[model samples]
Structures are given as structure tokens and as C-alpha cells.
Target: MIALKRLQILLPFVGIAVLLAVWSLTVWARIVDPVLLPSPVSTFRAMWIGMTSGKLGVDFLKTVERTIYSTAIAAIIAIPFGILLGSSEKVYRSVEFVIDFFRSTPASAMFPLFLVLFGVGDRTKISVAAFGAALVILFNVAYGVMNARKTRILAARVMGASRLRILWDVMLLESLPQTFVGLRNGVSLALVIVVVAEMFIGSTDGLGQSVFEAQQLFNMPDMYAAIFAAGALGYGLNLLFLTIERRFVHWSGK
Candidate 1:
């Protein structure tokens, strides 16, 4: 079992190595133009230079900040609203169409609307991300609450628990696993929207800005570097949520 666990840990690294090997071979064999597809070494070099020069660092931090802000805003708005809606079928039904409509709409499509409402500033970018993330979070959180065991709720009520107490102690805890799922999805969506916003909405610094600038200049290595940075950022954020879920939602599976 220990060996199996070790293999599981090493398998991802092995897969990554194999991918890198194939990528390197393609570049070495000139299957693709180096100008369009830089070698892994060149991309790594570019990333290192960007990091050392502090450009990537600054952009990375900006992207992280925007993601955090958007996610926080989404959570703040989603949790309570989701609970309220989930607690009452009437409330959920009343706004279900609206929620589904917005959720189905592409977040990028709403960028123009947000820009019109909030202007071409961080507000617009942040708001778009928050809006998209909130819907996803709300959907998951409400489902979590609605799926809470009826028997537990009945037990609580039979013990004379107040509505608020039942909500706070029972429903909230029951929903945490699904809420974390929402949070993980929400954060990913937030990052995607933020990067797209920075790319199109005139940002001074961000991973998206770096990528856009690099592409415009035909700096393939730099663009690849920024792309890798974005991927790493996404992986890191997901890992963080997974860690938090494991710690907090201890009873989730059982």
C-alpha cells in the first residue's frame, strides 16, 4: 500500500516528464516552427528571466490578488443567498430561471456589459469574475443545502431547535462539502475570467497582459512562459482548495 501510494505520487511527475520529452523531440525534429513553438528549455529560460526581472512576479501577484478578491466577493454573496434559497423551495423556484439563464451565459460575453456598467477599470474585471463565480457557487451551495438529510433536520426540530440554529449548525455543516466543491470551481472560473479580462480590458499588469503582449510581439517563448505560469497558478489554487476541504470536511465521504 505504501508502495502504491508512492507510485501514485510519482505517476503525475512521470507523465509530465513524458510530455516534456515529446515536446522537446518535436522542437528538435523541426516538426513545428521554433518561432511558433519554442523548446521547453527556451520557455523555461524565458520564465526564469521574467521571474528574475520581477515582471512575472508582479503580474503573478496581480492575478492572484484579483482572483482572491473575486472569489471572496462571490463567496460573500453566494453562501447566505444560497442557504436562503435552498431552505425554501418557493424561493429557489422563483429565481431558478434567472439563475440558470445567467449561469448558462458565457462569462466572457458579459464582459462588455460589465465594462459598460463599471467602466474599463479593475472594477469591471473584478465584477465580471465575481458575477460568474457567484452563480457557480450559488448553484452548488444551494444543492448542498437542499440535499441535507431530512432525518437530521427533523431530529433537530424535534429537540426544539430554532430555525436559525438548525440552519447554522446542521444545514451549514452538511453543505460544506458541496460548498467547497463550489469554491474550487468558482476560484478556477474567477482566474479564467480575470485573465481574459486583463487580456482584453486594458490591464497594466497581469499574466493575461503578459501573454497578450508576448503574442502581439511574436515572442513565443515569453508567451509560453506566461501560459505555463497561468497553468501553475490554476493548479496551485485547486490544490489549496483540496487541502482546505480535506481539513475541514473530514466527514464528507463517510
Candidate 2:
């Protein structure tokens, strides 16, 4: 059992190792043009230098700021609304169509509308990302509340819990796991939107803009480095939420 657990822990690294090996082999074999597909060493070297001594670091921070801002906005608006909607199944059902409609719409499709509303500035990009993330979070939070164990709710009522009390103490706690799930997913979507928006929405600096500019300039190493940075950022965000969940929502899986 100990060995199996250890192996399971190492499983994630195995794929990473295999991927690096394959990439190195492919580069050495001249399987593709080096200009288009830089070696991992070269890519990582660019990543290091760009992050340490170049504009990439600034761009990375800009992207992080925008993503964080959008997600915060979404959560601020969605959480309370979701809770209110979810506490009453009738209310949630009445507006389910509208919620689903906006959620189903691609955020990108709203670019033109936001552009017209907020112009080609940071406001438009952040608003669009916020809009998209809100729907995702709202849905999850509502579902979380709705799915709260009925037995617990009944028990709370039997113990003389009022609707507000049950919502605050019982339903809210029950919904935490699902809420965190929404937050993680929302942040991810926010990052993606911010990146894409940066590439085309008059961005002066950001990971998205960095990648776009590098590609246009044929700076393959820089482009790959930026791409890797974005990937690392996404992975880091997800891991951060997971850690928080483990810390605060320890009863999540239970």
C-alpha cells in the first residue's frame, strides 16, 4: 500500500519526463525546423531570461492582474446572487433559461458588444472576462446550494433553524465544495479570456500580447517561452485553489 501510494504520487512526473525526452529527441533528430520548434533547453532558457531580465516579467504580471480582477468581480457578483437564487428552487427554475442562455453564449461573441460599450481599453477585456466567469461561477454556486443535502436541511429546521439561519449555517457550508469548484473554473476561464483579449484588444503588455507579438516577429523561442509561462500560470492558479480547498474545505470529498 505504501509503495502504491508513492507510485501514484510519482505518476504525474512520469508523463512530464516522457514529454521532455520526446521533445529533446525530436529536436535532436531535426524532426521539425528549429525555428518553429525550439528545444526545451532553449525554450526554458528564454523563459528564464525573459522572466528575470526582460519585458516578459512585466507582461506576465499584467496578465495576472487582469485575470485576478475579472475573477474577483465575477465572484463578488455571482456568489450572493447564486445563493439567493439557489435557496429557492422556484426562483432558480424561473430564471434558469436566462442563466443558461448567457452561460451558453461564447464570451468571445460578446467582444464586439463590450468593445462598443467599453471601447478598446482594459475595461472591455476585463468586462468580457468578468461576464463569462460570472455565469460559470453563478451556475456552480447555485447548484451547490440546490444540491445541499435535504436531510441536513430538514434536521436544521427540526432544530428550530430559520430559513436565513439554515442558509447561513447549513446550506452555505454544504455548498462550499461546489463553490470552490466554480471559483477554480472561473479563474481559469478568466485567464483564458484575458490572454485572448490582450492579443487583440489594444493591450500594451500581457502574456497574450507577448505571445502574439513574438509569433508575428518570428521570435519562436520567446513565443514558446511565453506560452509556457501562460501554461505555468494556469497550473499554478488551479493548484493554489486546490490547496486552499484542502485547507478550508477539508470536508470537501467526505
Candidate 3:
């Protein structure tokens, strides 16, 4: 079992190494133009330079800040309302069309509307991200509540628990695992929306802007570096949520 566990840990690293090897080979063989796809060494060098110059740090921080703000806004608005909706079939049915409509709409398609409403400022970018993230979180949270075991709720009622008490003690606990899933997805969507906004919505500074500028200037290495930074940020955020979920939702599958 110990050896099996060690192999499990080593397998991912092996896969990554194989991917890198392929990437390096392609670069070496000039399968693509170096201008379009710089060698991994050049990309690493550019990343190092950006880090040393503090530019990457600033851009990374800006993107991360926007993601956090949007996610917080989404969670604050979605959770309570989602719970309320889930607890009442009438309320859920009444708003189902509205929820489904907005959820189905692509966030990018709403960019122009948000830009007009909030203007081409940070507010517009954050608002767009928050809007998208909120819908995803709301959907997950409501379903989580709705899917709570009937037996558990019946038990609570039989024990003479108030409706509110049952909601808080039984439904809420049952929903936490799915809520965390929503949170993870919501934060990812928030980051994606914010980055896209920064790239095309006239942001002065951000990882997206940095990438856009690098590409416009034909600086492939810097562009790749910025892209890598953005990917790392997303991975880090997801990992964080996964850790939180594991710790708090320990009984999720069981």
C-alpha cells in the first residue's frame, strides 16, 4: 500500500515531465514558429525577468484581487437566497425561469450591457464577474438544499423542531458539500471573467493586459509567461477550495 501510494504521487509528476519533454522537443524541432511558440527555456527566462522586475507580481495581484472581490460578492448574495429558494418549492418555481435564463446566457455576451450600465471601469469588470459567478453558485446551493434527504428532515419535524431550526441544522449541513463545489466553480468563473474583462475591456493593469500587450508587441515569451501566471493563479485558487472542502465536508461522499 505504501508503494502504491508512492506510485500514485509519482505518476502525476511523470506525466508532467512527459508533457514537458514533448513541448521541448517540438520547440527544438521548430514544429511551430519560435515567434509564435517560444522555447520553454525562453518562456522560463521571461517569467524570471518579469518576476525580478515586479511587473508580473503587480499583474498577478490585480487579477487575484478582482477574482476574490467578485467571488465574495457572488457568495454573499447567492447563499442565503439560494437556501430560501430551495426551502420553498413555490419560490423556486416562481423564479426558475429567470434563473435558468440568466444562467444560460454567456457572461461574455453580457459584457456590453455591463459596460453600458457600470461603464468601462473596474466596477463593470467586477460586476460582470460577480453576476456570472453568482448564478453558478446559486444553482448549486439551491439544488444542494433541495436534495437533502427527506428522512432527515422528517426526523427533525418529528422531534418538534421548528422549520427554521430544521433548515439551519439539517438542510444547511446537508448542503455544505455541494455549496463548496459551487464556491470552487464560482471562483473559477470569476477569475475567467475578470481576466477576459481586463484583456478586452480597457484595463490599465492586470495579467490579461500584460498578455495582450505582449502578444501585440510579438513578444511570445512574455505572453507565455503571463499566460502561465494566470493559469497558476487559477490552479492555486482551486487547490485552496479543494483543501477547504476536504477539511469541512469530510463526510461528503460517506
Candidate 4:
């Protein structure tokens, strides 16, 4: 298991290294124009320059702030409602309808309305992302709660466990693994949404803005750097979540 886990972690880095090597070789060979496909070295240099100037840091922080805020809001709003609706069959049946509808709705389609309402700021971006991301989280958490072991629940009831005790000790604990999975997915969606939101609404700064601006100026190296940063940030976020899951949902490993 440890060997498999190590391989799982190493494979991605190996793949990335191979890709970068191939990219550099191709660029050096002039198989692709530098303007079109920057060399890995060039991209890395651009990234270093951006970092040294603190542009990348600022943009990275802005995106992180937005993502964190949006995710927090989504989780707060989704979790309680998910628990409430999931606890009862009737509530689940009714709310499932709403969940399906909203989950199917494209966030990009609602961007215009958000811009109009919030005037093209962080709130609009965060709200739109949260709205879309929360549905997946809500449904997953609800399913987790609903599908918690019936035997355990029955045992708890027979043992005269209070409702709160059952919720805290059984339901939440039982549902945590599923909830974390949902959160992982939600964070992925949120990252995508955030980039799109920054692009559409034109934030003061972010990876999206950096990419957009670089493209306009035809700076392929810088554009690639921005994209690299975004990819690295997204990867880091997933890593952080996986670590949390491994720590808190250790029982699920069994």
C-alpha cells in the first residue's frame, strides 16, 4: 500500500518532467516557434521574473483569497441544508429535485447576471463560483448522510443515543469520507470557475488576468508561466485536501 501510494505521488511528477523535457527539446529544435510554444527554460525564466517582481505572488494570493472565501461560503451554506434534507426521506426526495436542477445549470450562463448585480467585482466571481460548487457538495454530503450504515444508526437508536449524539458521533463521522470527496471535487470546480470568473469579469489581478494579458501582448513564455502557476496552485490545493482526508478519514483507508 505504501509503495502504491508513493508511486501514485511520483507518477505525476515524472510525467510533468517528461513533458517539460520534450517541450524544451522541441522548442530548441525549432519544431515550434518560440512565440507559439516557449521553451521550458524560457517559461521558467519568465516565471522567475514574475516571481521576483512579485506580480505572480500578488496574483496568486488574489486567486487564493477568492477561492478560499468562495469555498468557505459554499461549505457553510451547503452542509447544514444537506444534513437537514438528507436526514429525512421526504426532505431528500423534495430537495433532490432542486439539487439536480441547479447542478445542471451552467455557471457561465449566470455570469452576466452576477456582473450586473455585483458590478464585476470579487463578490460576483466568488458568489457565482460558490453557487455552482455548492450543489455538488450538498448532494454528495446528503448522499453520504443518507447512506450511512443503517445497522449503526439502529444500534445507536436502540442504545438511547440522543439525536445530537447520533448526529455528532455517527452521522458526521460516517459521512466524513464522502464529504471530503465532495469537497475535493468542489475545490476542483471552484478553481476552474475562479479562472473563468477572473477572465470574464476582469479582476485587478490573478492567474487568469496574467494569462489574458500575456496573450494580448503575445508573450507566450509569460502566458505559459501563468498557466503553470495556475496548474501548480490547483495541484497544491488537491494535495492539501488529500492530506487532510488521510489524516481525518484514516478509517476509510481500511
Task: Show model 3 residue runs off by greater than 4 Å.
Answer: 1-8
Question: Which 10-residue span in candidate 2 carries the lowest summed lDDT?
Answer: 3-12
Q: How many residue pairs clash in each candidate?
A: 0, 0, 0, 0
lDDT of 4 by residue, 1-254 (tens): 99898889787699778987888789889998667997788889999988778588788888888888888888999888778777776889976888899899888888999889888689998999898879988988898888899999999999999988998789888888888888888888888899988876867798889889889899898898899899999999999999999998999746
lDDT of 1 by residue, 83-125 (tens): 9998887889899999999999999999888988999899999
Candidate 1 local Cα displacement, residue 167, angstroms:
1.0
TM-score (C-alpha) between model 1 and the true structure: 0.95
Over the stretch 19-94, how does candidate 2's per-residue lDDT look in tens digits? 9999999999999988899999989999999999999999999999999999999999999999999999999999
TM-score: model 4 vs. ground truth:
0.92
Itemize residue pairs with steric clashes in candidate 1.
none
Q: How do the predictions measure up, each by TM-score?
A: 0.95, 0.96, 0.96, 0.92
Tell me which of candidates 2 and 4 scores higher on TM-score. Answer: 2
What does the lDDT read for residue 126 in candidate 1? 94
Ten contiguous residues with the weakest lDDT in model 1: 49-58
lDDT, candidates in the order shown: 0.94, 0.96, 0.93, 0.86
In terms of lDDT, the poorest run of 10 residues in model 3 is 49-58
Judge candidate 1 at residue 239 and give its lDDT: 100
Clashing pairs in 4: none
What is the Cα-based lDDT of residue 76 in candidate 1?
99
Tell me, by lDDT, which candidate is best.
2
**Candidate 3, clashing residue pairs?**
none
